[model samples]
Target: MATANADAAEVERLYELGDRLSSAKDKSQHAADYEAIIASVKGQNVKAKQLAAQLIPRYFRSFPALGTFAMEAMFDLVEMEELAIRIQAIRGFPLLGKDAEFISKIADILGQLLTSGTAFLLSFLSSNVKCGYASQVLSCISEENVERDAVHKALMSLIRQDVKNSLQPLFKHVESGSEIREKIICFLRDKVFPVKAELLKPQAEMERYITDLIKKSVQDVTGLEFKLFMDFLRSLSIFGDTAPRESFQELIEIIQAQADLDAQFDVSDIDHIERWTSCIYMALPIFTVWPIQLNNN
Candidate 1:
């Protein structure tokens, strides 16, 4: 009974410290307070660690100037075995990377993490909502210009090394109608497509890679499944004016052929019919505009 009471008191104290950390106004002062928590027995406290993870990003977001210090502190937490702590630590990277001044500092650490933690990060992608955060990190790595070349090289190397093993698991979740699918589509858009023109190898190799991905994703589905495919294709079209025309045309032809067949199918189930109609509706804009855009270009 006495130990239980002591534990309760400890919990309350940690909660109060978390509240103070959250409300901390001065950057140095907040850093000091945060450091104290890390030094305290509460540093290893699970709840305290979770609170620190949540608050560290909030602090960095609110005080961009504190990013370097915050990120340095975060790097320590990234090594923590706890998933919650690791994820929150990972979240802080993209937020810090948004600032150009921080990108160089952030990129090296991110590249290291991506290289060393590829399996862990891939597991996050297989997770439902966590995948969104993971994708955001990849997107930040791809989009930032400061250290882009090195970061992109690291990213692509990791993808090429792990993607074959990774894609099979990802495809299992592809049909779940989760944001994982959308995040992957965006990742491919931002990462893969841009590099096609610059890859040192034969273009067919790159086009074949893209084509295989599309086929794996769209091959088994019809009706509503095509909706995910259409959305993915539309994202691809953002670079339609620049994307490999043959590849884009091939995907469009495949989708158009599927839409045509669905239109003619006997539609006794209204829900199925509605899904098919929606697929066609989604494809219309892509089908109509892509050819015209390609032609005019």
Candidate 2:
């Protein structure tokens, strides 16, 4: 048996050998070298295991017949005690994505990490949603008991991708009366309103995305949802700026669609409670809270 402690020279020798095998026309002639490399992946040496994890994926396209062994070896590395080695295996996942069926299998394994956990194991988020990897992101965030920091981090990343890319997948799954929808909207509200409300801070690039997110979230909302969220939107100085006015204009249309009364509003007739409440709901966000100064503005 070869010594498990693979030296630097041996690692270089194996790497150079694989470089030849990568371009070789008749790889079957070098079957012994391939087998030896695979064996080194299971060797008790850290460097050899990481080397195999990297090499297998790098030359994945070159050797079609050994894919199963390569994938299993990668998965084994994913579970290894060493973080660097696990990262090497994880980085190889996309290389193996050509097989959609196999990609789903990989997603399932990772979904467990992203969505589920306990103190006894490596405690990261886990996923229960069955969807393509793109949609899986939203599923993880939408899930109950998932940490707030994770959701916020994911939202930031998704918004960075494109605001629409973040919301479409999320709202696609969020139905009427869904806790998921409610939480998403509420989180968006809390994330922006507290900071924006306090300071007339100059618009940062991220604020633009957050503004777009706020605008998109209030769409198709009405009744209690529209009253609460759009009112918060109306109060933002962020929207008062020239740069974001167009975004706010579109959002105003969304507000009017949901909050505008069907019949002409009778302001003096505070006689009817339902009508008066509707009037108040519409007026509160538009008019500053100063009751006496409302007519001046």
Give TM-scores for every candidate, taking all chains together and pairing residue i with residue i: 0.36, 0.40
- Please give the lDDT score at residue 219 for candidate 2: 46
Top TM-score: which candidate number? 2
lDDT of 2 by residue, 1-297 (tens): 346334666688678778778888887677666766766778667887788877776666555677777778877886787655765666666566554435545533433333221221222223322334546454434432343344344344333334333344443322333434655555555653455532323445444554555556554554566666656655555544443435444554554544444546776655434534664567554334322222211
User: Model 1, 145-232: lDDT tens per residue?
Assistant: 3233433444454444334333334444444444345444444456754554554135445435544656667755545456655554
Clashing pairs in 2: 114-125, 114-126, 115-125, 115-126, 115-127, 116-125, 116-126
TM-score, candidate number 1:
0.36
Off by over 4 Å in 2: 1-6, 25-32, 115-297
Query: Model-by-model lDDT, in order?
Result: 0.53, 0.53
User: What lDDT is reached at residue 108 by model 1?
Assistant: 42
Our model 2 lands, by Cα RMSD against the true structure, at 12.4
